[model samples]
Target chain A: MRARVLVRPKAGILDPQGQAVERALPALGFDGVRNVHVGRLIELDVEDASQLPEMCEKLLANPLIEDYEIVQ
Target chain B: MRFPGSCDDVDALLAAEMVGEAEILWHGEHNLRGVDAIVVPGGFSYGDYLRPGAIARFSPVMESVMAFAREGGPVLGICNGFQILCEAGMLPGALLTNVSLQFVCRQVTVEATGASSAFTGGFAAGARLSIPVKHTTGRFYAPAAELDRLEQAGQVVLRYAPGENPNGSLRDIAGVCNETGTVMGLMPHPEHAVDPLTGSTDGLKLFQALRDHVGSLLAA
Candidate 1:
């Protein structure tokens, strides 16, 4: 099975990378883009999907500052 | 000893030992059985592949390190080690990129908020020390509720002095300890500032605190 994990900094947490991208967007002629946040996508090949949540909690995302979603 | 990424921490420890700062018996990750305290030195473990400490936390050695912390053994994580501890769920908050989107590498003053943990016990309340921080992602963040609990429980051990919070750490938190005070994670490199040759020895007090705590424990 193939699983994808999306890890994003929790809401209200400062996302410098996201902000930087937002700033650059205006110069590139992109307008009215608001609320940009940067996150990571991790893909993995595993045999069992049941253990993915455990993997997310243990390594893919930090519960304190990030929220993650698993897509199969 | 664990990885080549943070050899500077090991070099600093050796320098400290040579100066009689503390008696340290350095060992590799596999042999932490008789260790009194575990210092997870700063480094880009696993090349920081997924996240700074994300992959490294799953290393076989970390299993022993976590068990050691759970057994009330003192665990100190510096820089990348700090990142690992947070990822390991051993520390309270997570380190995010600096709000400025820059890698801050310089000396800043951090103050002791309280003398509750083995790491900060040697410093008086509000005592400030100069330490060097070098990282692109050092801003500390946690849920508001968790932050409040850390503050109330006196687990917030260190904070960047006013106007010295280089990164955008919430409440300027530079370091913190667990409720039991056996585990700690900090952004600055205390090991790098232990000698006057480095222009300051303010970082020595942190190591001194650990030595004192472990000494008292041995005596008990």
Candidate 2:
């Protein structure tokens, strides 16, 4: 099974990377960037898709800093 | 200034006194295979350039740290290591520059919330103790919603003592854990105060807890 994990910072955390991207957007001629919070995209090929949830809980994403969704 | 010249201090201290083995990975080399636990020791990695953990996050070593944590290995990040863990996306929330914009160095009291973590198992609920916090950018920031979720999930493992919120962290929080409690990051330097000669020995219990957990896991 293949799983794509979308890991994003928890709602209240400041995303410096996202902020930097937002700052550069207007200069890059794409001024529509708003509320852009950057996160990690991890794609994994797991033996079983049912393990995705456990993977998310154990390591794919940190619950304190990030929330993740597994798309299989 | 960075002290102790590497993670060896933590490793040697843990090994000699705590009955556990800690291997210090320099520059994040070598895959973290055959390791049950990991520690991102405190120091000015990459000279704290750009940001505390900013440069170190991209190191080859972090790749192994990430892989190990993904496989359910217990990981702990202290001081600068904590900043790196957040940057490496292993821990939640970002540690920003201190609100006061000063490098704080002193023994401060902390309250352990007993959030059921590998690092906090030795402490009782609502336990109060003193630990040293020495950093310039130790302020912890997270969205209110995320903080609420963390609290609701019992992930807030350590908190600053009442009226001792040195870094202006939300809810007086000093340290926290991932949902499963295998990963933890905090601003305090528990490794620094592990020895009684360092003014307070409260830090020993933290490392002892990790050692004990790893031992139990091995025995199991």
TM-scores, one per candidate: 0.92, 0.71
lDDT for each residue of candidate 2 in B1-220, tens digit (9 for 90 to 100) = 1122344245334632564654545664656547677777777777876457767777787777788778778888888888888877788887876766578988899999978898888788889878888888888877788889999998899999989988878789899888889999988877776667778777778878887888888898
Q: State the DockQ, from 0 to 1, for candidate 2.
A: 0.09
Model 2 quality (TM-score): 0.71
Model 1 TM-score is 0.92
Task: Please report, as a residue range, the 10-residue window in candidate 1 chain B with the lowest summed lDDT.
Answer: B19-28
RMSD of 2: 9.0
Winner by TM-score: 1
- Measured with C-alpha atoms, the lDDT of residue B173 in candidate 1 is 95
Give all candidates' CA lDDT scores. Answer: 0.82, 0.77
Candidate 2 stretches with Cα past 4 Å from truth are A1-72, B1-17
Model 2 lDDT, residue B203, Cα:
77
